[model samples]
Target chain A: MVNPLEIKVERNKHKKTKPPQDQLGFGVHFTDHMFVMDYAQEKGWYHPRIVPYQPIVLDPAAKVFHYGQTIFEGLKAYRTGDGRTLLFRPQKNIERMNRSNERLSVPQLDEALFLSALQQLIAADQDWIPSGAGTSLYIRPFVIATQPALGVSPSEHYQFIIIMSPVGAYYPEGINPVKIFVEAEYVRAVIGGVGEAKTAGNYAAGLKAQEAAKELGYSQVLWLDGVHRTYIEEVGSMNVFFKINGTVLTPALNGSILDGITRSSMIQLLKHLDIPIEERMISIEELYEAGRNGTLEEAFGTGTAAVISPIGELSWKGEKLVIQDGQTGELSKKLYDTLTGIQKGSLADPFGWMVEVSETPSGVL
Target chain B: MVNPLEIKVERNKHKKTKPPQDQLGFGVHFTDHMFVMDYAQEKGWYHPRIVPYQPIVLDPAAKVFHYGQTIFEGLKAYRTGDGRTLLFRPQKNIERMNRSNERLSVPQLDEALFLSALQQLIAADQDWIPSGAGTSLYIRPFVIATQPALGVSPSEHYQFIIIMSPVGAYYPEGINPVKIFVEAEYVRAVIGGVGEAKTAGNYAAGLKAQEAAKELGYSQVLWLDGVHRTYIEEVGSMNVFFKINGTVLTPALNGSILDGITRSSMIQLLKHLDIPIEERMISIEELYEAGRNGTLEEAFGTGTAAVISPIGELSWKGEKLVIQDGQTGELSKKLYDTLTGIQKGSLADPFGWMVEVSETPSGVL
Candidate 1:
């Protein structure tokens, strides 16, 4: 029988004992160790290890550095109220990672192997997980081309790494409101591009627009269709949701906009709460008009890190449309509460999304 | 008077000797040193140097690795009959790199600085230039977000680098014809994506299609429009051109096909040679009909590396359209020769395209 691959971890010899409340921004503080697996054409993924948090060395000609052949997944390791560490729906991340890898022509890895590796790595670095109020160990699993070839062909070698960062609340004080810029000139995703995939290229393409929005006093950009720049796609990293009349409307996954884990969770959560949700194309005109007529009750964005962030005002095309009470709406708070509650084990995980981590040798076998 | 920036050379102590002629494939042989510059929001671009060609150490959380915030420009240094090294249309590359940086939200580098860096790098790597026929030093100038952050925002820190690789002729035995696989299912670029920009993401997106074509024993995938997947975009990295009724036609630069340096160069060369050339939307239907009606004389793909590679056959929709003679056609060879002639200083630089890199460095104080 094939042995369950294990990782060796060297704990941080000098550990910090202070519970600093300031070390809580999302993706700011990382755990001590990380999981890594290397792959080559000659030999499959090997040299799996849990190494101390350090820089990765790569060839200057590596395709990932110059060509951007990279994809990543975001999930979290939450410490429950019951004092148990659990991962939420990690299989989804594994499956999506493969899909992205396939699209980018990166070498693929075993999903079961990946999940086990994550479990082991996180177990070792679990102490680095921040507890208390909306804080959790953010798990970032990513794969990249490591081949040193400079030609424009698919790389034969690859690296799959799982790194953990203790992240604070997305919103400093629970969930407040955010001003979003309606990006018209800049398009994040197109009909046939890597918009749906969590590829680095998609995110990189949005940086300028995001920078512009931030300078203009906007938190994020609400991307539109690349063709006509009319319909909404996504808000930088999150999936957008708009409440028009009664139905919660989100732009349908039309080959653009990331199929976010939180977006999917919200859809499932709405089903449990018996709330009507419509997954269809939501145009900018419809959103603006609905806001002006008071038909828009709320607008928010969903992603793994930020369970739900309310939209206060949309700055776009010489007009500012106020969404809801210019603050976190009731429905947005409800979604965040339920999701976080279930995550922290305060509420029962009836959906069986959380996989409880076994405390033995920690992440090592 | 602004003094010209001087490059500090840190040569590799253990540099490998140049490989033999047979092994000198395109982009396979690198020079001893590379030029680098670092940019940050706080300090702008600084620490410009020509360092040893070695593997770069990058943090696992570098944005370029995870977010793909990278862009690159390609040009070549050819050894002229008088033993002088030259870059063809180097300013065009600088201009294009900035355009690409704008699309990716990376900072724009000064054109003067870019040329100076290139000159220094090439001077240091001049020994690597192959003197044989059709051999030149392929220069890859790229910018990558080196910020050790996981966020999707535009990185505050960026690394700009220029590396040289001595490359042999694309086709060792004269210009050989290539078979193309027209991918109907997968679309490379769309209406408003980074297709026009020489960004890393655009290349990453095409890898899968290229792999599929390779698996099928074809050279490259002929991409089409994303929505309809009908109109011809380009074949992999190069712009496709077809000769019908003694007139040359190429797919219009309609946001999908790259505005290739060689593509435009050929158009200029053909027009100067009294050949009628049109840059307009080219459809798959038009190509197939033209090929079948014996009106299509030649078809070729143009890029920096292989200035003009003739398309032998096209496999699409269960049908095959064999280009005339299924060999390097007359117009293809003419276009290739004319372009190379200008590039090699054999012909006049009519458009004032070639910017001579003066050895004396007289432009600066």
Candidate 2:
């Protein structure tokens, strides 16, 4: 176990002016400080510190640059109405990060140490947490293999760093529906691959497909299973859900689909609200059939970046399937409101999902 | 086109002692200087230069660190018996690097600039090339997205770099056959993914499977196709070949397998020698059946790192299929010698595959 007291703090001598909250776009503006820890095969993880946000110096032959042995987690620090900072189920992200580490053959980070680092860093930079409607400080915790050798095996050194960015609301005005293209020519992941892990390579593999979808004027790509090429896997980088005949359906955790924290939370929320939900293999053909038969009521993508992204249209193989008349469905809006309300502390917490952060740096309890 | 004369050269002032030829390992010790070029959306690729080999400075939020937006190519510089330096099939690698860039949504590099960079870099560090038996300078050319943003998209900035390392013979004593494990639980790549590209993520995805194989007392993992989980894709990171009943068979250029330069050379060599060669799908079942019937004469893997690595034994689902009586097949030895001979400028350049590097730096062609 790492002692919280051992975490050194190096305050920034010169801090940049903070950008206006309204002008902050996604991942554009960063905070003053970042949390960093190093890992060596012989020394374990050491030198946890909160230092000025700066450029990282790495050998050109670092394994992360050549082999992509990296993993990351995304969550947010929300400013509640009561002037308190809250995080939505951060423990889940930490747990999933470890699972990613296991899959990527990177070293495991101590859960307590992870949480402590997050808390201390958040407390130090809490002023960057935006209070605007639907706005929050996005926390990105990533681990990269830092071994300066050009080997194809697990790296002998690593760096776990946490950087925070003040992101504007995904939807500036309101939760608008997005247009998605069903990708048939490119695949994101397959069964028994690294899709379930929040690793860098999975995202790298999807860039071409995403670019193609963009050129076709779609906001994202809805990926199918690489094997059958029919079963739904993900919408862009998010988990997909469809309300067909009043029953919510999502692709099960079948080894390839990411176990999205937001997706899991939405499922729990749906069950609490007494809405029927099912996790199974939902093929694109079945989804299109539901659209044609007028049984597909609503569709949405769930992720940390966008609490709930309503899907208004899905274009697949030259056919456009418009749901809810290309509008945000009632259930989609309701889920979005409920989830964001809980995250921002406007509504009563039913499942105790929100974890509050101390305003003062307590040096990681 | 990048002007060769525009490339600025800055030599290293204090060079470190070069490692002994006998002590050289694969990609362990780098030369004193490296080639670098920067790319920006607005400026394009510029600032081509040679500088002292040092650590690269990048923002913590660089896309390569978070999304694995990177690609690399591997080739070797061989010091001939008469002191001339040669590069085997470098144009193939340069063409393949651009193909990888296209697949990964990265900016395409000029093929002329790539070759010039390799030639100049190798020329500048010509003294580092080892001349001992089976020693060569391994050249690693790579591009990494350097945009410091967390958005999961193609980066607007990139850095292309070339580094060289002196490497000893893959098998210092002689060509040795290795034991391979046919992986079923994990997949290296799938059709419509980044597998065919020589990108970082594909290698990262294979690390876990390779580690598992190493733990099971195997030197490498023979990957099966992601969709079928039976059709052969690759052995470790190399293209696989099987010789059965006097005919050489390799997997077709499926989107899930890398098109290795050595594999291509071997095919051409087989044709030159009037040996039968076929490129098509061959499943593990068929291979094991051939082993059972004593028709699986030989097996080997081809890549730039080892040139040709013979496989003596394969373990699949608790069955050990020994090939060529656990010894290096005659064809494997002949192919290795022929290829290495051509690379080192010791044998006749029948196909003109070897490109000689100028002793003096010729900035660019």
Candidate 3:
């Protein structure tokens, strides 16, 4: 467990100058410090500390490199207008990460310790938090198998690390709607697989289709269920949503689709706003039929990085469907504003999703 | 590409003492030297060299750690009776690795460069080769995305590393047949996924089912197709085959089953022997019916590690099916002898598969 009093902080002797706020792109630049904890089968988890951000040296035979025994969580820290920082529903991310660990056979992490560790690391790198509009410090917490062996079983040793990167808008075009390609030739996951968990393998297995979609001038690929290849599962790395005839619908968690925190929050927000929403299987054919009948009102992808990414167009099997006249939909805009407002402390905390930095022990440092 | 005269080798300053030959297990022990090369989008692949086996230093945000953008090939260097070392179908492994690279969006390595690299590495650690019966030096050549960024796309930088480990018999019980649990609840791969590719994610997605099978007292799991969960896919990490009524049947490469080098070689050998074999979809139901009627004469799994692993028993959905009275079939023994005989260079090299070490620059080195 992370004890704010017990966490050893090793300050960097030579600190790197922060990149220009506007130039920050995704996970390209890292903050000064990182939080790390080690896990062994016999000793469990030990040695929680904050140290200078540096490359990790691992044996060539580490299982993480060979078997892809790794899991990760991604969230962002928003700098409010009043100079306060906030994290939106970070406990959900930690809970999902533990589920991922269970599927990957990694040890379960204590949720309170995990949250405290993130707060400590954020405290150590508070200067890196960007205050620019649509800019925030992206936090990536991951666990990797470090046992120096080539066997395919679960590793005996593991390392849990949290790294921070100041990132701008997820899409370079800001909140604009983007074109998507419906992938039918490849599958990201199947039922009874590790797709529900935030493991590295799902992304690795998806690179080929993603690259192809990018080359075809599409922003991302809309993946279908592996078994049926008919029902929509996700869009790129985000959970997808569609507004058909004034009803919001997203895919159900059918063992292969990731249970994204952003997607859940959006569902809750939609319900709060008195909008009808349902989590069910939405097939491409049905969506296209709705498009033909002028009932496909809005579509978007929800994730931690993008919050809400509107889908302007979808091309499936050589057929193209323009969504909302290739523009950002009204609901997508409202959801994004409401969510970001809560995250940045600009609105009243109705649902109480945001956890302010001052509420944690960051002030103690 | 592998000009023996052009290769540079660095010997380890502190050589590791060899473990007992018979006690050598799987990938726990490493040789002194390893093959390494680097690739950048601008520089292609450069700096091919043999260095002392050591840990690889990488930024915490390297794509391989976060997205599992890694591909690997596994083969062995076998010491012949004439005191020469050989690699069985080494080029096949390279070709398969290239296919895996394409699927994982990793850069493809030149086959010539890959072969030369292996020979150079084996040359540097020739002394570590074990001479005991059934002992061979296992070589694992893998490529990983090394770009220090977390954004999920093709990596701009990569590393190709080859490490060797001396291993004894794959099964401690010799060639005895083992029980296999038919996995109906979990699917290893689907038709439109990275199942055929030799990537880390495929293996990582399979650990849970494998662990559960082991706990059920089974040697490995017999995977079914992801869509139907009826057609047989593979057995653990190996390709499976069955002999029914003097005819051999194996699941076709239907874009899901791995094109195992050993499986291909066995097919070629069976064709040469005028044996009838079919590479088509074979369902567990059909096999079970044959087992009940006593027409399923032999069942075996093939891979680089275990050339012919007999399946003595199969438990599908709690229905037990025993074959050959829980004994190794006659054909299983014959195929094992023939494959191992070809690999060790004690038998005829009719297929021209074995690449002798002396044929390359190893003798000069």
Best by TM-score: 2
Candidate 3: regions farther than 4 A off: A1-5, A359-364, B1-6, B359-364
Cα deviation of A64, candidate 2, in Å: 0.3
How many residue pairs clash in each candidate at the backbone level? 3, 0, 0
Off by over 4 Å in 2: A171-174, A361-365, B171-174, B363-365
Docking class of 3: high
Screening candidate 3 with a backbone cut-off below 3 angstroms (N, C-alpha, C), the clashing residue pairs are none
Model 3, position B117, has a per-residue lDDT of 82
Score chain A of each prediction against the true chain A by TM-score and list the results. Answer: 0.95, 0.98, 0.98
TM-score of each prediction: 0.95, 0.99, 0.98
lDDT of 3 by residue, A1-365 (tens): 44546767788887899999999999999999999899999988888888999999999999999999999999999999999989988999999999999998889998888988888888778989999989999999999999988877889999999999999998997789989999989999999888898999899888899999999999899999988889999976799999999999999999999999999999999999999999998888999999989999999999998888999999999999999999999899999899988888888879889987753485445
Let me know the TM-score candidate 3 reaches against the reference structure.
Answer: 0.98
- On DockQ, the leading prediction is 2
Query: Candidate 2, which CAPRI tier?
Result: high
Fraction of the reference Cα-Cα interface contacts (below 8 Å) that each candidate reproduces: 0.77, 0.86, 0.84
Model with the higher TM-score, candidate 1 or 2: 2
Q: Write the per-residue lDDT of candidate 3 for residues B1-365, one digit (tens) a residue.
A: 33434556676899999999989998999999898888889978888778899999999999999999999999999988888988889999999999999888887788887888888788778888887888899999999899999888989999999999999878776689888999989888888999999988888888888889889999888999999999999987789999999999999988888999999999998898888999999988999999999999989899888778898999999999998898999988988898898888889989999997753475435
Clashing pairs in 1: A120-A363, A123-A363, A124-A363
